[model samples]
Target: MSTAVDDDLWSAVGDPTRRRMIDRLLADGTGTATSLSEQIPVTRQAIAKHLAVLDRAGLVHGATAGRERRYRVDEAQLARAVAQLNAVGSAWDSRLDRIKRIAETIQRTGGGSTAEPDTEHRNEKE
Candidate 1:
């Protein structure tokens, strides 16, 4: 909502493997490192490390289930991430629109040409 970027959260989701893990957990409703490793290319240990990063970013939460911790997506935090992305995207769109308007104005005023000689540079040389 504030367009504030969560660097830690973004960094956690930046990895393609971790995004795949998130997708897997979301699809299955829950997943363990072992289960995810079976579906993903990474080993169970690597999956566990990636899960730790997600946990630290508040993107996913883990609960002890027998020998392994079962993980699930944090819907609220995920929504927050989505809102941030939308806000940033809207900001960029507004900036681009403003730039386009300025360019159109310049073209209409016939100020977009570069045919004139550089009088300043000529004076400097003299």
Candidate 2:
């Protein structure tokens, strides 16, 4: 039972461009499509498209400021993303720890591998 946030949030942040956009917005406090395009390699239209995706994921919010739309990273949503990432990292750490224990046990028992040759696949020449 994954929530909408869990699903779309990754998709939105998965793009390298969007991630860069988020970084820029965070660093600059706020930015417009034109401003972001200047910092990024893409055009202003592309920046707007990326911003739209981020906005849909609730990672950013935009406010109309005169002629341009100013975008900023949503603190709450960013916090949520960080929490999710931490959870995934913790899970992987636990899995690695278990694997390390298993390896250590095998090493201690000296049962890691057998030196015996395979008789089942022996040829007539053998």
Candidate 3:
């Protein structure tokens, strides 16, 4: 079963803008919507919205820093995301290896086509 966090996590990071926001946050250690807007091309409101999504995904946490909130990336959640990506990559690699072996076996046996011949059509032609 999939959890809400998985969906939110992927949704948050799927957008280029949010990804850029994360990168900037990582580089700067912590940031506010106003500060991020200055570094990114978007408006402060947009940055805030992206930050909300990231916060929902558990990718970042925000603390009230006077008037504006200061956001920092959550290392543990980021590590979880990395591990999920690695697991998916390993599964694909295993599947590709299986496919390669099957192809090699077919080639060695000179079985160029897997489809069977149409006997009825061949009889009609003959």
Candidate 4:
């Protein structure tokens, strides 16, 4: 997916309420706004809005079911999201490993204390 689309997806999932809504839909296999609202603390209208955002992000699919629309997680899109998360996590892990190695090298070379002390605090005390 494009970066814009990826950003939208991430933004959609970034909200705690929306993430809980996704969890509810996944746990229940499917849910309507009314049904989800009953389980969640939000109103049905709020749930509908969150669902709309999820739909726009391609995280969930909705279909008309009688008077209300039913929503379910989109497995393929979810997998793609998971893949993106894993990629990001791996990149961070690599960066942290490099940072750890650098810190170890600095400690061994007695360069870890290269920074000056907090002279401002000493001046304030005086």
Best model number under lDDT? 1
Consecutive 10-residue window with the lowest summed lDDT within model 2: 1-10
Q: Write the per-residue lDDT of candidate 2 for residues 10-126, one digit (tens) a residue.
A: 888889999999999999999999999999999999999999999999999999999999999998898888778777888889999999999999999887767676766676447
Total clashing pairs in model 3: 0
Alpha-carbon lDDT of model 4: 0.91
The TM-score of predicted model 3 comes to 0.82
Estimated TM-score for each candidate = 0.84, 0.82, 0.82, 0.85
Tens-digit per-residue lDDT, 1-126, candidate 3: 222236667778889999999999999999999999999999999999999999999999999999999999998888777777677788889999999999999999998866889999999999
How many backbone clashes are present in model 2?
0
Over 4 Å off, model 4: 1-5, 112-126
Clashing residue pairs in all predictions, respectively, total 0, 0, 0, 0
Best by TM-score: 4
Write down the RMSD of all candidates, one decimal each. Answer: 4.3, 5.1, 5.7, 3.6
The CA lDDT of each predicted structure is: 0.93, 0.89, 0.89, 0.91
Taking the tens digit of each residue's C-alpha lDDT, what string does model 4 give over 43-66? 999999999999999999999999
lDDT of 3 at 85: 69
Q: What is candidate 1's lDDT per residue for 1-126, written digit by digit as tens? A: 455899988899889999999899999999999999999999899999999999999999999999999999998888888888788899999999999999999999988768788999989999
Evaluate residue 66 in candidate 1 and report its C-alpha lDDT on the 0 to 100 scale. Answer: 100
Clashing pairs in 1: none
